[model samples]
Target: MTEHTSIRIRVTGHVQGVGFRAWTQARAEELGLWGWVRNVADGSVEAWVSGPAGAVADLVEALGHGPAAARVAAVETGPADAASDAAGAGFRILR
Candidate 1:
């Protein structure tokens, strides 16, 4: 069977109001991953992603840089439970 992985990411810094959510969606789609990205009340961008382990890793790395308008400070990653598999079939920009 193919390898699968799931994780939660919290990106801090200049992520809000910078098209970060849309950029994340595009990147996840390009990587053929499924997940949801949203802005937290604390001005951080949080995401839960699930896909091939390598793809997820790539997404995480890309997240560190984010969009050109985003000055990413830190990317915090950790394991996420199956309940986080909420995007159903595609990547999404959550409100």
Candidate 2:
């Protein structure tokens, strides 16, 4: 049976202020994933995702290329706590 999985992705390189977070929000919604994307002061983008394993994998692959303006260097994904309340239904952009 398919199971729900939570993923935390830290994207390195030029991924801030270039609509990367917004793009991720849209992408996650398109794949019916629940998550939140945010920009960090360290010039990276972080996201907490929860959904079907396949969809989460797709999201991570997309994040590596991000928006046209974003120069994504790397993407790291891992298991997240099941009880973590990091995001609500539908993808949102965090401050």
Candidate 3:
């Protein structure tokens, strides 16, 4: 079986108010990853994604070049604790 991995990422730049969360959700879902994306107070986007390591990595790469409206400056990624529940089964945009 393919090993799954989780990652927490913080994307900075023109990420908020530019459909970053929704765009991220769509991208994650397309990759069959489960996790959530939200706007941070500091004008950044944060997300926790878990799935096949390759898929998660792909998502991270996409975050760097978000929707055309977004001007992603940086994407920081780190390991995240895996959840037992079906946390990665669906992607969501959190407020």
lDDT score at residue 73, model 3, on the 0-100 scale: 92
Task: Give the runs in model 1 whose Cα sits over 4 Å from its true position.
Answer: 86-88
lDDT of 3 at 63: 91
Listed in order, each prediction's TM-score against the native is 0.94, 0.90, 0.92
On TM-score, the candidate that comes out on top is 1
Name the candidate, 1 or 2, with the larger TM-score value. Answer: 1
Residue 5 of model 3, lDDT score: 87
Each candidate: RMSD to true structure? 1.3, 1.7, 1.6
Candidate 1 per-residue lDDT over residues 21-95, each given as its tens digit: 999999999999998999999999999999999999999999999999999999999989787785448998989
**CA lDDT, every model vs. true structure:** 0.94, 0.86, 0.88
Please, what are the lDDT tens digits per residue for candidate 2 over residues 2-86?
A: 7778978899998887888888999999998997888888888888899888999999999989999999888987777667555
- Give each model's clash number: 0, 0, 1
What is candidate 2's TM-score against the reference? 0.90
Candidate 3 lDDT tens digits, 1-95: 98888888999999898888989999999999998889999999989888998999899999999999999999999877566336646888888
Alpha carbon deviation, residue 69, candidate 3 (Å): 0.7
